[model samples]
Target: MNDSLTFCKAIEALAANIWPAEITAYLDNWQLRATRGVTKRANSVLAIGEYPQLANWLPHIEQFYADNSLPAIFHISDASPPGLDALLDSHGYALGTPSLVMIANSQDAAAAAAQKLVKRDVAALTAEWVTEADEEWLDAFLRLESYHEELKESYKGICERISDAKGFVKIRKGKHIIAVGTAVVQGEWAGFLNVVVSEAERGQGLGSYLMQALTAWSREHGAARQYLQVVASNTAAVSLYEKLGYQTKYGYHYRIKYDLRPLATS
Candidate 1:
């Protein structure tokens, strides 16, 4: 393989190991899992390397589920063997919504320094700021959702977590929230998510201001990098992030349909 592809593959492997822990830390609390033989929606076995024994692995996978009394879910990607899809189909494992695997680097100084916009005099969001369980937050999110529906539920979850946890920031005006965002510390890396601005407040630079605020906070907390995901199709967001000094370290593809539920038998 070429050096660039090899380096990317190495990073993907590292991320595969590191990210699963991050997801499990949170998902294990509310999400369900079953170990029964690779049927789906149970124990999710992720493969980041070669897959040699296609046929023999099934019984072992089934045994893993049957032994644990849980359903078995195998997460595979295009990097895997071509036979994986057919094997899963023959074994009755259903597929789930695909996830985008995006990455970013914070070490680029020019990009970070290029973000020179001045912030407005809006109030900072705090634990007490979102105490009312208000609809204003939900409303702003719904407006954003109109443009990207996949974010609707995810934004709700982030808002709820920020309301209950630390690392969330906001700017409000007289009981109305103009902008909101949340950040999380992961070693030397800080991740940003759930940034939203009111529909009426868009052109006023609230979105950019919140971004600068989040970046400043992440830097202050000793983070050497900041990362986030924007839907591949959102040109506006891609432009904004590019202007702010974020580079596309990689891209992940995804597809979704709202009407149909996943089936293990398929």
Candidate 2:
């Protein structure tokens, strides 16, 4: 993309396909999404393209989430319209998670794909790659991520909703799955989601193996570039990506305040 804002919007579009919401409404240039508040990305208003008329849509936006028993959450970025953050601040929305959007070129993707677990570690690790996540793979991922029971269904729905070129990777040691990751290829861009390595498997190089397998999957699907979102505070993850040649292209955060104002019924 020519500018950061345009690039940011492009990533957001790719993300929508990779992490679909149960309900989506395109109001003006903003995308209002809700997935029962399972994850902030699937629940926030993606403020893109237009200068959101905050006053005009506040009530409707509030009531929309209220119907689902969630507060309004806005995904704010460097591209978000000027003063939007300030208005949210004035309206008492508390700032939330700060995340980074890191990107790597084709060379980096290939380099990661070249790293094979067979040569590095002592134990034999079996890597399996699939076009979609199955029940067994989903169970392993949920357990590794330690996701709540209430949120599992929404997460499963998100995985099922991906319609683009997608791949799911699972790394196993013996019979137990130790890692899970997903990659989606849209045009030349490959975006990663829900990458998790079992707690006991961390620091044993499985994360790198997982990334390599996912990179290979992306390459097979015609992706030439890679992007992933990581919380800025996650130093270990940030370090791993940086070593793979990823650089922070931009950053975004959520602005949220939980006040469930249910819609008025007729």
Output the number of the lDDT-best candidate: 2
Backbone clash numbers for all candidates listed: 10, 0
TM-score of each: 0.54, 0.92
The sequence of per-residue lDDT tens digits that candidate 2 reaches over residues 109-191 is: 56754553446773578888877688878888888888766766777788889988888888889888988999989999999
Model 1 global lDDT (CA atoms, 0 to 1): 0.49
Encode model 1's per-residue lDDT on 1-266: one tens digit a residue: 55745544554443332222212211211222332222221235554345644445545544443455445555555444447656666645555544333445555532443344444443443212343224555565455545454444434443443321226565665666567766665556666656676677666556666776666666667777767655667666666677766777654331211212232121
Give the lowest summed-lDDT range of ten residues in model 1.
22-31
Model 1: lDDT of residue 40: 29
Error of 1 at 230 (Å): 1.3
What lDDT is reached at residue 110 by model 1?
A: 26
Where model 1 places Cα greater than 4 Å from the true spot, the runs are 1-116, 119-166, 255-266
Our tally of clashes for model 2 stands at: 0
In candidate 1, list every pair of residues with a backbone clash: 34-42, 34-70, 34-71, 35-65, 35-70, 35-71, 36-65, 36-70, 37-62, 125-170
For candidate 2, the 10 contiguous residues with the lowest summed lDDT are: 257-266
